[model samples]
Target: MPTVPPTPSPEVITYTVRAGDALAKIAAQFGTTVEEIVEANEIEDANRIEVGQVLVIPQGAEIPILCPILWPLTMAPTRC
Candidate 1:
């Protein structure tokens, strides 16, 4: 019997925060919301994103893994 391939999942985008970059702007650029970005990134302060900070931008309902260099430690895995 012929086997079927698995469906492709939504892509996870990683963005590096730039100077004067805000959650709102980033969300708009990525076609997402600030709240979603905050939750996906586990950001303590949505307004406190640092320059060069890497962020995970989930395309759909699935959340991807966080950036490894977030804190120089092993970051815990989270579900979608």
Candidate 2:
């Protein structure tokens, strides 16, 4: 019998609140909806988040951010 490979777990991202960041915008940036973030964070109200709050961005389903390379030209075409 052949062994099967296990699926990888989703990764979580975090974002800090800026001076003018709203829940809707934050969700949009993560390709999700504000309601989803609220539900994930157990926020009772969607409009009551405070500034400088460190919210756990539920980007489990979204693509990860690629780090900037010091030598962009050295990167493979497929990676670029």
| Top candidate when judged by lDDT against the true structure | 1
Candidate 1 TM-score versus the reference? 0.65
The number of clashing residue pairs in each candidate reads: 0, 0
Candidate 2 residues lying further than 4 Å off, grouped into runs, are 63-80
Worst 10 residues of 1 by lDDT: 61-70
Residue pairs with clashing backbones, model 1: none
- Give TM per candidate: 0.65, 0.65
Q: Per-model C-alpha lDDT, please?
A: 0.81, 0.79
lDDT of 1 by residue, 1-80 (tens): 99999999767788899999999988877778999999999999988999999999866643434444545455686443
